[model samples]
Target: MSRPEPLQPVYQFSSAQEPVSLRQGTVEVDFNNDRFCGMADLVLRFLPGPRLVFHAIVRSTSEPELPFFLNVPDNLSVSFNGQKMEGFRGRWKANGNTLEFDWIPRSQPVVLSDMQPKNSVAAIFHLFNFPEFRGGNYQEVAPLGCALLVLESEDWKISLQELPEDATREAWDQIKNEGGCFLTHMVKMERKDGEQFSGEDAQEQCFLLDNFLSFINGGRCWPVCGVGLDASGETTWETFASPRPVRPPYSWFNPYKASQAELLFPLFAKRWQQSAEWRDCLHSAIYWYVQANTSGGSPSIDAAIILAQAALERLAHHYLVVDQKVVSGKGRASDRLRMLFSACGIPNEIMDATPDIRRANGTFKKDTRWMDAPHAITDIRNSLVHPVSKKKLHDCHVDAWKLSLWYLELSVLALCGYDGTYVSRLTAKYVTDSANVPWGKKA
Candidate 1:
């Protein structure tokens, strides 16, 4: 597919004072003359996650040097084709006259040089496998730091817009057929405040949004590339980032169909402003959940089950003791999980559970009767971790994993105080099917 035009001519690599056009994911970025090494041609490739990779072969003197170092002075000041670039880390290996280099940014978000302060900031982010909105090419989602604009409390706003559809269709189609990443969604952020906004600030805001978007998308929503704009709407920062290499599964909220974006996002922003523990717990839960679902490697089904159980226990502790303050931090895992589910308005029975899971649980009997979700989930997890407990059927273990994941999803949505519709793995007839949250007023 022909590469769609970028938001602007933001990437400016040059050689011999001539502009270099980026094509087919590769470009030659020239190096500046330095004490240890002379100017060399550095081949750069932009991977699917907008990950940057650099390779170069250069001659070095006998003077031993670190594996890699920035070619720029003090590792801060840099310019490519007259466009300012922030400092980034580089790694290399020396093999006589053939020195190989790999460049990856070390938490140093790229900030373009600006002549003067700007009152507002705008940022554009490219998303992988994000669903497009139905019936329209544009949708205004939510703001950061606040719920309502009437209160003038929000610091930034977010919107979803379509890219060049025809130009990008072939690339997206390839991704759908073969396993790869493509620019599937375009996300825009605009600061509402009048104060001067910097690239550093934009990075922080984007990080917060990334976490929220991941939870909503039920997968990693790392930006393939990001472009920051000043008040006058001029480019101020740009960076290609490494995103998790995984295709998204069925997400809870399908922005293309029905979602709780308007309600859920604001609650997240509010919690971000008022609570620190909330932030930590959510991040941990998201990390564990993703790890459980990630494929590949050895017999990871057991490990995945353990991760899901661990997340449930952590969230249960947080919801019962930390946030709600209704119970002490001491209790059986099953009891705590039950309490957490009750507080979230999630049912205790396995009846409402997905048919396969409910059927699998029925096959296992404890005390002459089948256990409920909390008991069955915790029991199976116990069998895995402890030698005294009876081993569960392999099918039961898999179903328990699914049941635990369902509980985890509902608990999070309830914690956010969301009442809007969501796609449920238990009931959805298709990928885009959705229903109201069980605990929500609308339900």
Candidate 2:
């Protein structure tokens, strides 16, 4: 028929003539040309997410650069780690030996799976070649050569292929040196292609990175209380032994073990309680709060506030127990309460009043004031507990909560007859030094 259509030009090639190799972590892949006969340029890409997916594109070398297509034969097979992958359509034709497919070994969270083989790099390889021309018919061409492709997880990519093991360890050490608190954020890799990924600048993401590194570095456990250094390089915890007599070991005695007052007094007298001063207190408070609320869970604003309040309460109790006047109840309850108010330096007249303390104006009767600060604190607590509000939360809420807790602790200490200086010191350590607070080593 028309001289057999002059035998459409059919060219055959084999991957056996050319070869390519690629490696990532412990996974390795090799490609050879003899398998498919064709000239082609191969491209590979790696993506990060629930599962690792590798994509490949192959273009055949032709006068105008033709697309590679394949009508895959029944004998052809695709596999990962020696295991044949199922569900391939197997309907591609040889346009130029170009093929595309995902190479996810299994359907699972990539972080939790062991996709990379030990001592072998994970990669996707492509083989290309052209088929030889026959008398008057065309025959399917086998694969010629293959090119390897690699894709890495986001963190792996940012770390430049380095595993997270070391960075985590370093972060842990930093957390241990500071208080028990460890915060970090996620960091996205800078793509060579100049594209930005999601959450690249989120502050929480940065915190996540820090915390992850801390956990991996064995810095999870740290002392929460006791004497420690503050931002100013001065000891924040006031010891009874210090020149300040208001420090600790007050007259208040534990009713159950009055005899042990001597033992407990010395502990209190040794130092002014500081949430920031003692690494142990900070550590313990954070640890206890986290254990009580957030262990093995995601972080939330309410959880953070609850943890902070718990820590503050512990510090307040230690200060209160050490004050002499509070233990003996020598002054009027109202007066004692007033002294507590003065200690924190809050001029709220209601602070010194008893539950029945009436207002001089007499317009509002009954202990409404008692419900005020404590109620305000409770409102803050509620906000912390239930953070799901349509309104955006600002950092000021945390600052207010911290200030309130400090005031509460100072008042408790004042009721025990401790001077107010400790409150000032604590404020300086936490509020004024907020910007200068030492972050753990770079994760």
Instruction: Assess every candidate by TM-score.
Output: 0.75, 0.23
Worst 10 residues of 1 by lDDT: 144-153
**Candidate 2 on 1-443: residue-level lDDT in tens?**
12111111011111111211221221112223323222221111111111123232333233323332323334333333333433223223333445443343232111212322222111111111101111111111111111111112232222101112233234334434532222111112233333332221222222222222221111222111112122343332210000000111111112122122222222222222332344344335434333333322344445555654565455444434343324442432233333444445554432322222223223333543234444334445545667663323343354334444444434333332332122132234331121111111222
Q: Count the backbone clashes (under 3 Å) in each candidate.
A: 0, 88
Task: Highest TM-score: give the candidate number.
Answer: 1
lDDT: which candidate is best?
A: 1
Model 2 misplaced stretches (Cα beyond 4 Å): 1-298, 322-341, 344-374, 382-443
Instruction: Summarize candidate 1's per-residue lDDT along 1-443 as a digit string, tens digits.
Output: 33323342234421111222221222223343332333333232334334443333444444445544334332533333344434453666555444455444444333334423443367776665554445222223222211111111167666554444332454456556775555554666766654566666666667777777777666667654567676677667665554454566555776555335655776777766666788888888877776665443332767777888898898988878887798898778999999888888888887655565566656656553445678877877877888475544466666677677778778878877777777876667786777877887674
For candidate 1, the per-residue lDDT at 394 reads 60
RMSD for each model, in Å, please?
7.7, 26.9
Whole-model lDDT values for every prediction: 0.59, 0.28
